[model samples]
Target: MGTPLLVAEDISISFGGIRALKGVDLTVEEGQIVCLAGENGCGKSTLVKIVSGVYTPSTGTISIGGDSFNALKPRQAIAEGVQVIYQDLSLFDHLSVAENIAINRLIHDGSVLSNRAEVQRIAAEQLERIGIDLDLDAPVSELSVANKQIVAICRALSMDARILFMDEPTTALTTNEVKRLLAIVLDLKKRGMAVVFISHKLDEVFEIADKITIFRDGSKVGDFTASELDEVSLSFHMTGREIVYNRYHRTRTEDQPLLEVRELSRADNYEDISFTVRPGDILGLTGLLGAGRTEIALSLFGLNRPDSGTILIDGKTAAITNPWDALDYGIALLPEDRKTQGLFGQQSVKTNITSTMLDRLLTPMRMISGRKEDALATELVHSMNVNNKDISVLVDNLSGGNQQKVVLGKWIGTEPRILILDSPTVGIDIGSKSEIYAKIHDLAADGIGIIFISDEPEEIVANCNRVLVMHEGSMITSLEEEDLRADGIKERLAEIISDPDSFAGTNSGARVQGEQA
Candidate 1:
């Protein structure tokens, strides 16, 4: 390892009376990947903001490339080759890839002239530097999430960034996409650039980190070499407690099915999908990217229309052609991308919690009843264990886990018989994930059928009593009974997903459904 590229000592910051960061210290060496692990609101983002000059710390000293500054301005940080890629990526959606890569440099250099050839050359150079190939003329909106991430990296390199800070970079990527991106980060490290990574996913953290720094409750817990820490120990440091997860097993009280889909078909999306969610059953739906798991969820939620299918709720055929119709039929969907599709970030927590049941809170004058809304919000918040003392605070001000809880409260307020949670724990810390899993188990215990959709085998194995694997818009395998309850069920499901044919003839009661299977 080379000399430290950047260091911050005794970093402390506050927002009003809240101490966002307290006595946190961080050091990043050249060619090193330092992963910051913590629960949401544990000072990781605040530290990043302090380092990148977004927020001036109340006390600290930042030393970058042997130059010390008590406080750095945003432009000064950029001049020192510090670049941060936020979760959003913050690219121009309408601009071409080449323009998006070169525009920041052009603006920084105060260039007013249009030079298409120059922009393409610069973009090509950055892409070549990172060993990536992207269509220069393709608009940013047209790229996949993984491709957009690569573009963001290239753009950062175009600014001559010596140190890169990435926040939750793989929250939306598939396993394959995450592997590819990690490979690129390794290559960058090989070229002697420093990377500061922040993520809630521990497997990725252990895979890519040379050093691990953990924080909890606005304080730095400790920093250790990656070789000295494992997932359990790291999670303990992050949450200040041991995190234990038990596999969920359902105890059913009713034999009647809560939801049943027969011959559900949507061209280019999903086909011949058949499954049943019984009362108290947490059925898992999983597959790789574009495997139609989410497409199936959307169809059930009435966001996507199917060509031919029969949806039976409580043994009666129901026509759910829209979201309202689906809600009326006692179906609620917790969408995959909670930040975009689920919560209203700009709205207050109270409003977000009571959003789905506003009709029940209206008064005789047809105006919203504040008293009723407050009562319902209080009930849901307490039930969901949301950690906000003020319900009037904007949902955006809460942490990712809390925001997710609010979204859950919103959907639960509808009192649905069937709930579909699509990637509900993505980008959430281990502590928060455990709480959410317990809540899911409790809801199932209350006789609400759950259709859990995720790409991670461990999550599926831990939470579901039955699982359906999809591939290429087709149901490939069905695992139930002892197959789901076995000791190595997680590994078995992973193997099946990677190569379904290998398990096709096994005597484990696994059924191969589609032509691909």
Candidate 2:
């Protein structure tokens, strides 16, 4: 560690008589990586906002490179080389990648003319500096979530930020992309830059952090060296409880399959995808990003129109050309990106949870009944185990885990026979993940066929009874019952996902016979 580049002391803030942060102290030294870890709404974000001048602290002193201030303005913080890459990335969607990256510098430099070449040069230089390549001419809106995160990082580097704060950077990233991003962060640290990485992922924190800080209920719990803590201790500090996740095993039922897709093919998206999801089975779809796992799920949910296929729900041909048709055939889809596709953030929890079945809450005269809405919302909240006492609270005010539960409740209101959960546990904390896993098991035990989709091998191995591997828009292989029960299953599944060709000739225990051409 080098000299301290940024320090905040006695930080506390309040909004509407609610203390968002309480007496938190943080220090980021030059050439050091510090991880700020806590459950959602634990004041980690509040402190970062304060240091970056997005929020003023109720009482605190901030020192940037030994220059002290009671509270810094946004421009003042920028002048002191502080840059924050918020989760939203804050990029101009309509602008090209090059323009989005260089626009900040051009504006800061007070350039009068639109120098397109200069913008391209600056963007290219920053991308090369980070050792990541991206299309300069591609519009920001056209990039994937991972690429957008890289753009955000490159933009931060363009500002020559001495210290960078990344909020939940890896939440949307795949495993490989996360590794690359961590490498970039380490590279930045080696170049004498400070990084404050806020994440719920303990593995990444242990892999990259020099120091780890824990926060709980708007107060600092403790700060410890990476060597001083493990995941168990970290979880204990963050949630005040020991986190435990039990491996799930499917309960055997009769031979009737609840949902089946024969040769489901979508041009340029997925091809020859065939699978059978039995009632009360949590069948997982696992592969790298863009491996057609989500594409197949989308088709099943009627979000994507498959060019050729037959969908059998309860052994009957279901022509699901649209989402309404899917719903009519007793199918419910919990979409991948919950924020954009699932819940109404600005609405009350009652409104979001009961949004799917509002017609069920009508009065005798066919008018919407507030009393019925409240009763159903209360029932769903209790059944879903959502962490909200009041149903009227805005969904945005709840934690990420709670918000996800609200989405699940909304979909569960439909009471479908088949539930498609696409990355259901993404960005959720460990405790909540366990809870959600239990809920999934419960749903399956209730005879609801679940099509669980995720890129994480451990989750797939733990929660799934049978697993199918996809590669390049095709169903590559399926892990049989014995394969799912073997030791090192997660590692073996990961290997197959990383490279499916390696197991083609070998008796790898996985059912290569199930591989699709």
Candidate 3:
């Protein structure tokens, strides 16, 4: 390979007493895919954060094209042609594709201040280069996650970035979309652009990578050519310890659905959404981003009002006018966006956990005692396996997985009859994911109806008794028992999206039943 576009040596990062990255070494050859594989807390994100200038390494050297860049700041890193596409893709959805792509140029207001047409032309060219032919004026929010990711790639390419870092690029992409994105990555590699691909999916890594590095507990396990690794070995390296990747083949309870939504319509977002979540049963919802998975959860949790529908709780029609109303009806929700919607970042871990149960903690004086609060909080923190030195610690300081645990812990403490978790394992480690799944299983076993909404299909198929597929604001179809495979669900969802009326009774058709978008 030609001179490496970027190389980092002995990168070490520490957070207080915890060493997030220890002696981690990596290299990105020009026009090549370099994959960093590890469990969530194994320093993959931390390493990428260092490369992207979001975090400074405690000890390390980062060189761009053989030039040392130890002190490079984020803007400086981008200026030097380094781009990090985060898990969310970092695109502001409200803006048009053209505006999102041309952001940097707009920020600089360069000497060509009067050349607005030229800027648009350049953005259009970048889009074309990335094989995206969408309307430049189209709203990014309207774009599918796969298309949005391509738009992000176009924006980075617009910067003329020398090296691009993709973090879990396909976490939300369908198989076809994933293939298309990979083709684009390969095309970029052919065009001599370096790529650092970080993913939880090993098959994608093996398919795309030239070199692979595994990190465990902030330390590098080993680095080798793609030819030197396989799924078994790569996974073995990721977790560092033996793990049994077992899923409950069938965890359904014969109990009928305790919660039912009928003819739920939410205007333009989702339409005629209907599904049943059974008590002592785990009902999983899966779809692409903007596929109405989260939308359905939010609507059921009273975060959004359905234009018209009947939400039946325990076979009884109920009005969930607000979240408090949902809570009053024994419904609890763990929102998708944790920092904003899930947790109060500034509060203590204890306080965050107990906020959902004030009435239980109150005295006859209607006041909560700090001691009772601490006791309850301590029990929950331990139960959820939230990692924190002290219950008094601010929740903001904990890792993403711990924060997520706290979010679930908050709702779990409420003892709701119905629990809805939206992407509950988004940022959690494999260990934590197992823990959370166990908790979900335990809850389901206890007769608490659970709605598990996730972008990961395997997860839905594995943990849930029934898989509900939503698209364009409605629960289009559902898969049970033998038909809940990821590919099967996507096909079914697409068919329904094309014509909900047409695919009403078809059992996951392979035939194209509706108009393509």
- Top candidate, metric lDDT: 1
The candidate 3 region of ten consecutive residues with least summed lDDT is: 508-517
Off by more than 4 A, model 1: 495-517
**Using alpha carbons, what is the TM-score of model 1?**
0.95
Please give the distance, in angstroms, between residue 12's alpha carbon in candidate 1 and its true position after superposition.
1.3
Taking the tens digit of each residue's C-alpha lDDT, what string does model 1 give over 109-182? 88998599989998999999988899999999999989999989988998999999999999888777888999
lDDT (C-alpha, whole model) for all candidates: 0.89, 0.87, 0.79
> Candidate 2 has which clashing residue pairs, if any?
none
Cα RMSD for candidates in order: 3.0, 2.9, 4.5
Off by over 4 Å in 3: 1-3, 53-56, 74-76, 88-96, 105-114, 138-145, 172-176, 226-232, 249-256, 262-266, 269-275, 307-309, 474-476, 482-517
Q: lDDT per residue, candidate 2, 40-114, as tens digits?
A: 888888888899898989898999999999998888898899999998899999999999889888888899886
